[model samples]
Target: MHDSHNSTAARLFETEGTGNPLDVLKRVYGYSAFRGKQQDVVEHVVAGGDAVVLFPTGAGKSLCFQVPALCRNGVGIVVSPLIALMRDQVEALKQLGVRAAALNSSLTRDEAIAVRHSLAAGALDLLYVTPERAVTDAFADMVADTDIALFAIDEAHCVSQWGHDFRPEYRGLGCLASRFPGVPRIALTATADPHTRDDIIKRLGLDRARVFTTSFDRPNIAYEIVERDQPRQQLLRFLSRFKDASGIVYCLSRAKVDDTAEWLNTQGIRALPYHAGMDRALRDAHQDAFLKEERLCLVATVAFGMGIDKPDVRYVAHLDLPGSVEAYYQETGRAGRDGLPSEVWMAYGMADVIQRRRMIDEGGSPEEIKRIERGKLNTLLAICETAGCRRQAILAHFGEAHPGRCGHCDTCLKPVETWDGTEAAIKALAAVYRTGERFGAGHVIDVLMGTINEKTERFGHVDMPVFGAGKDLPPRTWQSVFRQLLAAGLIKVDHSAFGALQLEPEARSVFRRERQVLFRKDRPSSGKAARGTKSATARERSDLAGSDLELFEKLRSQRLAIARDMDVPPYVVFPDTTLIALAKQRPRGFEDLLDVPGIGESKREKYGEAFLAVIDAFEEGGG
Candidate 1:
C-alpha cells in the first residue's frame, strides 16, 4: 500500500492504447451494443471532452462514462449522491477486476485510507464519491493531482437549483474542471426539464460542453391519475391486479407510509415502510430486503430510493400526488424500465393540491414561489381531470409535442364520454356566486344539492335561486362539474385558505349562458375497471415474438442473480432494454456484441462473463 503522503504525480498518466475501447467492452462488461447516444458519449469522454448526458432511468447512462473511464488515461472519478448506490456500484465494478473504490460516510477510517492508497498507487480505474466529499479540499487535491480520465456527475439534476433534490454543496463542483483543466467532465441525470437543464449546465460550468439528450418518453409505462374519492379503498383495488408484483407506494409522510404499509400487509401484501425517520440499521435492512426479496412493496416518502437501480419494478403508485410534474414523471419512469409493461397509478384530491402549493410557497422569493405554485397547480389539474391522453398532456407541459393519443393511458383505453356540461357548469357557477364563493367543494355541493345544513341556513344559501337547481345531479357529478368549471377558468381557488372557491370574471359569462361551457356529462366514476387495466399503449409495444420473450425472461433471471451476487440492483447490471436488444440480436461472439446497443467495454468485461455463460448455456440447451 502506498503512503497517504505520497504524491500522485505518476498517477496522472492516461491508460494509452488501452485497446480498442470496444475491445474493453467485450472484456469488462459483456455488452454487445451501445444504447441510445451511449456510443457518441463514450467516444467524447474517451477523447477527454466535457459532456452533459440526459438519459431516462434504466437507459444505461452509467456506461456512457464508465466505459470511457477505462479507455482514458488514469482513474475516473464518479460523483454520485446516493451513498448506498455508490457503494453497490463500486463493489460490482471491483468484482469485474476493475480497480474500483468508493469514499463515503459508510466507509471506516481504514477503508478510506485504503482507497486513498489505491489512488496514490494508480491501482484504481474508477473512484465513486458523493459531491459533498468530492469537493472537499482533501479529495479535490487528490483528484487534481491524479491522471483523471473522467469526472462523472451521477444524478446530475441535484446540482441544479430547480431540481427537487437541490444541494448547495453541488455548486462547488465547478471547481473540479477549473482545478483540473485537462481532465474530462461528464454530467449525467435520469431526469431534467429544459429549465433544469439550463440550471445544470450553468451550475456545472459546462456551457461549452456537448449535450446528449435521449427521448424522455417511456412508452411501456402508462401514466394515469384518478381523483381521490375513498383513497385507501381505491389503492387496495389498484394493488389487486398486480399481486406479487414488485411495486412502490409513495406517501407524503412517514406516519402515512407506516400506516399504508401496515394496511397493505393486513390485506396480505408483503409491504414495508421506509423513511429517513427510521433507525439507520432498519433503513439499510429494509432497503436490502426490498432489493433481495420478491413481492415486497416499499411504502416511502420522497426521501427513499433516489438513485435506486431496481429495473424490474412493475408499478409505482402514488398515494398522494407529488409536488411537481417533473417529480411525477421521474417517479413513474421508475416502472417499465425493463421495457416491459408497467402502470403508474396515482390518487389526487383537493387537499393534495393545496398541500403541494403550500410546500412550494414555504420558502423562496415571492416571484419564485408564485411561479412554482402556478406550475404545480397546472400540472396537478392537467393530470387529474384532463380527458385527453395523459401522456400527451405531460409531454406538452414539458414543451414536447405528441401528434395524437397515446392509446395507453386509462383515458385513452376507456375513453371518457363528453356531455355539454354547459348547463351543469352554469348551475355550478350560479351556486358559487349565490353562496359568495367562499365555501369549499363540500359546502358548495351542499348548497347545490339544497341540503339544509346549518352553515347553508346561516348564509341563507338554501333559499337562493340556484340552491336546488342542481339537486337532481349526483354528488360525484356535481364534483366533476366544479372541477370542469375550474378547468374552464370560470372559477379560481384562493391558495391562502385551503383553496376556497372564488368566482372568476369569466364565471359571469358562463353563468349567463352567453358562452357555452362544455364539460363531460356522466363522468367516468372510480370502479373496478378504472382501478385495474393494462394500458393499451403497453400492449401494443409488447410485440416481441415468443422466442424473444423466452430469451428475455431467461436473460433477466440470470441478470438478477448476478446483480444479487454482486450486491447491486439488477438494472445496473443490465437494463431490461439491453436484455431485450440482446435477446433480439443474439450476438454470436464478442465482435458481434459490439454492434448491440448499450454494450460498452467496461460493462462488457464486468458483466460479460456471467451473461455470456447464461447465453451459451441457453443456446446449447435448445434456447
Candidate 2:
C-alpha cells in the first residue's frame, strides 16, 4: 500500500511524525499556508488514516484531500454528488498542473471510456465519480483492482436519512470500506449538525475515523432577513449593489424560478432559470453559463447549488424560507469563497411560514421524523423573528457559541424593538378553538379583526366572542401573532384539516396567562425598506474604482472572447478571482502575472501572454 501510494516523491508524507505536504500545497494549489486544521488533515490522510472533516465553507477542505492525493502516486477516487462540482474542481486542478478527470453522466460515452482507460493504465492523480457509479459492479471491480490512494466522500451528510439532501445512492458508499479494507476513507461535509454527523459516521462505516471540526462562523457573509413586502421590488433593490456580479436567487418552486428569471431579465439583469424539471441538457447549459459568464444570475430551485464551486458568487437571495438552518447555511455558504464580502438575503412572508409548516406535516416521514423536522423549522423561524443577532442565533443552532453580537447581520446593525404579545396570543388561540379549529391562520386573524367576509359569515365565525375583541391591531400585527404562535408550538398546523390551525394541548398554560409571549416589534412596514448592500470589502475585479474598474471590464470582455473561442466556460479559462487580481495589480509581464494569486505555472504557460497583453495595452494607452 505504501509503495503504491507515494507520489513519485522518494518519501511518503506522514500523518504522525513529519512530511512536506505544505510544499505540495504551495507548488500546486498556490496556497502558502494551511488554514485551521487543513495541515493536520493532510498529514493524517497522506499518512494513511481515515478522517471525518467538518470544516466550514471557504475553510480550504479541498486541500485536505487534494494535497494527499497529489502526494500519493495512485489516483484518489473521489465520490462527489454533482457533475458541475466535479467539473469545476477538475478545471481548477488542471490549472494547477494536476492530472484530474471526471466520469459522470454528462460525459460522452467516448469521454467516459477514455477516463476508464486512463484509470486502468494508472495515468491520473484524481478520478471523480458519483456514488451511483461507484456502486456499479463493473466499476466496483475496477476500483477493487486499482492501486487506490484512498477514497473521499464529499457532501457526506447526504448519507443521513434525516438530512435535506439525502440521496439513496449514497447509502451504498459504506461498501467501499468493506471492499477495500486497507484503503483509507475520508467523509467531508460543510453542513452537518451533531445528529447528521453521527449518521454520517454510522452510514459510511467510519467508526474509527478521526473527526476534525473547524469553526462554523463565516464572517465574510453579511446576513439579512426581510419581511416579504412587494417581494420582486425588494429583491431588485437588494440586488442593485450587486449589479454586474454573479449570484443565485433561489425560489421554492420550479415555475417560480422560471417566472423570476424572466422577470429579472426584463429588469436588465442577466438571469437564467434552472430546476430539475428542465431538460438535463438545458439545466446543464444554464448552470455552465452561470459559472462561465460574468454578471449572470441563476434563478433556480433547491435543485441547484450544493455542488457549485464558484468562488466569486457575491450574493444568495432566498425568495422563500428554507425548511432548516442547515439547508440555508449550506446554500448560502456558496458565496465569497475567495474571502471577499458577500451577502445572504432572504425575503419571507406569512405564506412562506405556513407553507413550510404544512409541508412538514404532509411529508411521508414517520411521526418522529416529522417532529424533528418541525423543530428545525421552528428554530429557523426563531432566527427570523428574534430581536437578537441573526448570525449568533445561526451559529448557536450548530452547537457553537458566539458571546457578543456579530455586527454583520441585519438585527445587529439595526436593533429590533420588542413588545409583549401575550394578550394577543391568547386571543389568537381562542379564535382558533372557538372556530372549531377548522380554519388557517389567515381566516383566524380575519375573524379576530371583525372582518365580515363571506367565509366568516358562512362559517358563523362572526358571532364568536373573540370577533372584534382584537380589532385594535392591524392585519400585519395579527399575522405576526399567528406566526409567533406557530413558531412557539402553541398552535399546530393540521395538514389534513385543509391547513387549519389547532391549539396545542400544552398551550393551556399560555392561554391562562401563565406564559408571557414577547414579540420583536417589527420594523415599520412603510415606503421603501433599506437593504444592507456591502459596497466595500474585498473588491471583486469589477468593483474597482476609476481606471481599474474600466480595465476590469475590458479584461472580462477579453476573457469571454477567449472562452467563446475555446468553447469553454470563462471560469474554465480563469475564474473571477483571478481576473480581479489581474485588474487590481495590472501584471506587466509573465513574472508579474505568475505573481498574481491564481496563476499557477501551468496556467501561466498556457494563457498568461494574452492576459499580460491586455494589461500592457492599457498601460501604453494611458501614456
Candidate 3:
C-alpha cells in the first residue's frame, strides 16, 4: 500500500489498504466511490506520505483526510482554523462511530483534561485542534511520544501572508514536522492562487510534498456580476429567487451589514447581521441561529463566514467587490457544499472599486497600496467583464487553464456579444477631461446623456463637444466600457487632482489611434437565459407538473425507508446526484446500476440485490 518514489504514489494506497477501503466507503460514508481524488489522496496519507491538496468547495475535500484518519494506524492530528469547524467535524465523525475529539479554548478545564486523557489512552482515532492549541508544549510532547500516523493541516492557505485570510500563527506549524519527523503531513486548502500556493508551501516547509489539485471549478454555481446601481433592489430580486432558502449576503462595512439585514427583515426574509462591531453575544447567537435553523440567511461583512460547514447554503451574494480573487473564491465557494445547485451573484461598480483602493491606500505604503489596488481592481474587473466562462476565469486567475466554457456559468448559458467601443471610450474619456475631471461617474454620466437636470446645467456641462456623443449607446454600456478601461489601465483616477481623470501610459495608444476598445452588450432575456442565470434545478423542482413530481416523491419515500433500515442518511444512501443520475439513466439491472456514479463494488454487493430488484419491479410495472 506504500510507495515512496513514484509520483503516482497516491494511487497505490487506494488498491492496498487494510482491506478494500471501498467496502468501508459504501457502508460507512454511504457512497459508492470517493469524489475526485479523495480515494487516492486518502491512500497517500494512510501510506505515510506528505501531500498538499487543493479541492474546490463541495468537492468532498474533508473525506480525503477523514477516511484515511480512520484507516491509518495510531491517531491522526488535524490542525484546523475555527472552533466551529473543529466542533462540527468531531460531531460528524462521532455520529459515524469514529473516535474523534476536539481540543480548543472553547472547552472547560476538565473537558480539556478528559480529551488529553483520551488521547493518552489511545481512545481516539482523530484529534482536532486549532493551530494555536497545537503549538503548545504539551501537544508537542504528546506528538513526540505518540506514534501519530498523520498530521493534517486544514485550511492551510492561512499559512500564507499572501492569502486572503492570513494568520501569523499558521506560519509556526512547520514545527510539527520538526517535533515528529516520521509522521506524514497533508495540507489542504480550498482556495489559493499560484503566489499564495507557493507561499503556503514555503511557510509550511512542505517542499518535498506531492501536490494533488482537483480542479478548482464549481460547475454547479451560476456566477453573475452586475453593476451596483440600486444594489438594495438588486439584492431583493436575488433573495426573491431563494424565497426562504439558506444563503449569505456579504457586505464590506458593519453598518452596511446591519442596514442590509434590517432591510431584508422588512422584506420578510428571516435574516441576521454579523460583524466584528456587534456585541459578542449577539454575534455568537446570530451565528448559532443561522447554523441550527433552516432557511435563515445571514448578511455579514468580510469578518464572517470562514470555516462554515453548512452543506446546503443555496446561494452567496456579495454586495461589493472582494479585495482579491482568492477572497472572492473562498467567500463564494461557501455555497453549494453539498454539490447541489447554487448561486454566486455579485454587484460591483466604480464606487466599489474606488472604495477598496482607497482603503488599501490608507493602510499601506504608496507602493504597497498600488500593488494591492492593481490586484484588486484586476480581480473586480475580471468578475465584471470576463467574456469567457466565469469558472474558467476564476481558475485561470489561480494559474490553472480551463479547457473551455464550464457549461454552467451565465456567460456559457447566454453568451455576451461584444462590440467595438473605441469611439464611445474616446468620447467618455473626452467628456471626463472636458468637464475638468472634477466629478464622479454620476455627474459625468449626466453630461454624456445631455441630461437637462440642475446638476448638469449647474456646471454648464451639457454644452461640451463630448456631451451627448455617447448617447448612441446606453449609459449602462458606457459604464461597463469605462470600468473595463480603468481596469485595463487606459485611464487612471487622480484623487490628488480633485478626483480628476488622467490618461494612463496605455491611454496613449488610444490617443495615438494604436489601440481599439471593445465592450459587451446586454443580451435579450429568454427562458433558457433566465433559467440558466440562477438555480434552474431548484426552479425545475418547483415548476414540475403534478404527476411527474408526485412519482418522484413516491420513489424518494421508498428510498428513505430503505436508507433508514440500513441506518444512514437518505442522501447518503442515494445522493441527489445519484438519484438524478438514475432518473436520467433509468438503470434496469445491476450492469446499468454499476455504470452510475457513486456506485462501486461494495454498494453492488450489499444493497445492490435489493435496489436492482426494485428497479426491475419498476421497469416491469412500466415505471
Maximum-lDDT candidate:
2
Candidate 1 lDDT score at position 340: 76
Candidate 1, superposed: residue stretches over 4 Å from native: 1-19, 362-367, 487-490, 504-516, 521-526, 530-623
Colliding pairs, model 2: none
Q: Encode model 2's per-residue lDDT on 149-202: one tens digit a residue.
A: 889999999999778788989999999888788888999999988898999999
Candidate 3 per-residue lDDT, tens place, 386-420, comes to 67677877888878888867677778766778888
**Whole-model alpha-carbon lDDT for candidate 2:** 0.83
Clashes of 3: 0
Whole-model Cα lDDT of every candidate shown, in order: 0.76, 0.83, 0.74
- lDDT per residue (tens digit) for residues 316-432 in model 1: 999987877778878888776666778889987666665665666565646774675566566657666777788887776666788648887878877766777778887777777
Residue 358 in model 1: shift from native, Å? 3.1
Q: How far off is residue 357 in model 3, in Å?
A: 1.1
lDDT of 1: 0.76
Candidate 3 regions with alpha-carbon error over 4 angstroms = 1-20, 365-373, 431-439, 442-477, 494-500, 522-529, 532-623
Badly placed stretches (over 4 Å) of model 2 are 1-19, 527-554, 583-594, 620-623
